[model samples]
Target: MDEQGDPMPGATVKVKGNEGNGVLIGTVTGPDGKFSLNVPDRKVMLEVSFVGYVSRLIAASDTVSLKKVVLKEELKNIEEVVVTGYQRIDRKLFTGAAAVIKAEDAMVEGAIDVSRMLQGKAAGVQIQNVSGTFGASPKMRVRGASSINGNQKPLWVVDGLVLEDVVEVSADDLSSGDSETLISSAIAGLNADDIESFQILKDASATALYGARAMNGVVVI
Candidate 1:
């Protein structure tokens, strides 16, 4: 099951050695996120993994017949996984203009908004607060505007959910304001503390996945 208690279809379930190496038996979860495997005589570990979620390894027991497993959404430590448009690649092998801002660097003491956290952090990205009001969001542009007929704002993605249009988050879900930090519409409703990291994708090579919607650029969080 996923963190939402919904069925996590297509989750990989593999049997590994005690040391977390060598696959013994491998299968995938069904529509209900359930699986059954015939255990071997020796002690072994069960490894389960899914996209957009953290992988887990657990001890397998022949005596047990049923096991309930849940996969949590990955919120941090994505240094190895670099999301480049439609696909994910290794950070070392990516050949695009993708700049990564680690979680620790963005979660500063007084950082209350994504604009403040990203200010002066990424290259070719400009952030300026237009209003001084308590809830005024800043104006952000990646490599300046790319289109005159459409929006010039960069597309924002949080935990794989893209926000190209207006966002409708509950007011009660927002964090308390420390003065005015109204920044951008795509990122205005986000909580800084909950963000794991920020990946600014510039250049046409990095923004090609979204087609015309990514003409300005993209920010994967």
Candidate 2:
């Protein structure tokens, strides 16, 4: 479970062995945030990991066997060092127009999906809700209005890899008010609380690294 006691589905659980490079067993949490595994040793090390949350290592003991474990949110400060995907630089030495929104700061109550979270969080970044359906993604613009239609979308990046839209649909259909077509999004199925932070690049020097794909600007998560 997360700090808020929310069930974390699909969280990975691993059993660590002694010494180096040893993995005994592994499993994932279910929808109810419960997992079970039989280990070879009575006392084993368990590592729980979920995206954007701090990982925890626990000792498998009789007392804690059936108890619930909580994973805290990862609060990382980017003022010390700046990891801009392509390179690493000191924050003071780096000069670029970038805005960061921490998960805790931008979170809305009862909001598992973040399509509306970025609405007014970052500067120069505009977000419009294309659909009101559950898990639907919002339309986003880094500098300009979403008036050009959905001809293109801002590049989606996680860690250092780029993500492509899974569903291919035209802007005309999306704005047609049809509920089915409006239920499209890249991170719709993702839990907003799992995100650590959002880095918005609003300047040329900051977005030049992505070339044409980032012509609209860059959003790093």
Candidate 3:
């Protein structure tokens, strides 16, 4: 672990079976002090041992999937670090409403479009798929539409690049069946599988990053 009791980066991780004859698997933790290993589909007793910490044993079955595994620090005197806006703060020093959704929960919605899966998932943000057309994209608005002339659509940022004209398909196009009439003139393309997570920036404090462009809001994909 780190000096602050967090997972130590570059820490050596070793996994072995209860039987001494089993092969030894070795790996190093990342900067997040996290490591993942994929073993064969079989019943075995797995052991995780680090340099300075006590070894831990876990029973593994063919059907079991280890999604997240957290290792506890041996020392009890170290303090934990809390991440904040461009800074690391103590958890006891901050007050705010924050929610985190895992991959399992997001997949359970069975939504082909990422925007549709966000419905009823987050407050203040609204998602509407007004068309039943095959591969029809959804309409998303954070907080609410603020402008009449200017675009009400949120800014879509993929990776570190800001996607220009993210909302090319207007509501009128969907309603008037213009999108259906034109085979190759549909909306801008975006693959949902490429997205790791979606974050909606709402309220003035969150929307201030993009200046006036974020008056409507922003979506980080």
Candidate 4:
């Protein structure tokens, strides 16, 4: 029986050698999660894996029976994997705290500006909208402003590449500045549908890789 007390029918079962290299010898657990496969008389390893289920491996002996094997579903957290600097790591293994916001959640508040979508999405991050204009820009800060004279903006990285001097135009730019002037917009050019996930690195350990530029924070898109 599986964790839910239901039979794992059509569960894929594999037989492997001790070195973790082997073939897909056979499968087990039909609609009832029960099946059998013949193995050699030598000490060998057995691995069972199925979609939406956690894989399990066990050592089998000649006298072992293949009855009553249970398979359980894998429960994954949405924030389990975080973008750390230029790399990705399991959030539990990370030494610092970070927040992850999916594209779907970002659109929940009907936020047209990409930065506005991040408002209230993270615990420590703060987002301030420049205005209600159609092309207005939003300012983002992790924790709080850390620099007095230098730029307090966090570094932005998209698809593993560092984006330099990313700028956004405020509503004032549209009302007061030349109508033909095109202000730099960071999130305006990005396709929200194409975004897989975003990570806001606020802790020191998470931003340490970027050196002084990331002292305020880092945003990985």
Top TM-score: which candidate number? 4
Q: How much is 48 displaced in model 3, in angstroms?
A: 33
Poorest stretch of ten by lDDT in candidate 4: 174-183
lDDT of 3 at 159: 56
Off by over 4 Å in 4: 1-79, 166-182
Local error of candidate 4 at 65, Å? Answer: 16
User: lDDT of model 3 at residue 157?
Assistant: 55
Encode model 2's per-residue lDDT on 1-221: one tens digit a residue. Answer: 88788999999888865435564578899999998877667588788899879988788775464488899889776564555778766567778877767878888886645657887887777887666666556667786754465455667677777766677666666666666554455556667767888777776675567777776667777
Clashes of each: 6, 0, 0, 4
TM-score between candidate 3 and the true structure:
0.49
Give the alpha carbon lDDT tens digit for every residue of 28-99 in model 3.
778876676666544565565565565666555522323334455565442433222334334455443322
Better of 2 and 3 by TM-score: 2
Quantify all predictions' global Cα lDDT against the true fold. Answer: 0.70, 0.72, 0.54, 0.69
- TM-score for each candidate, following the candidate numbering: 0.53, 0.56, 0.49, 0.57
Give the poorly placed runs of model 1, Cα more than 4 Å off.
1-80, 147-150, 165-184
User: What is the C-alpha lDDT profile of model 1 across 121-154, one tens digit per residue?
Assistant: 8888988755545655556788686555555667
Tens-digit lDDT string for candidate 4 (140-160): 788587755555667777887
Question: lDDT winner among the candidates?
Answer: 2
Instruction: State in Å the error of residue 133, model 3.
Output: 1.2
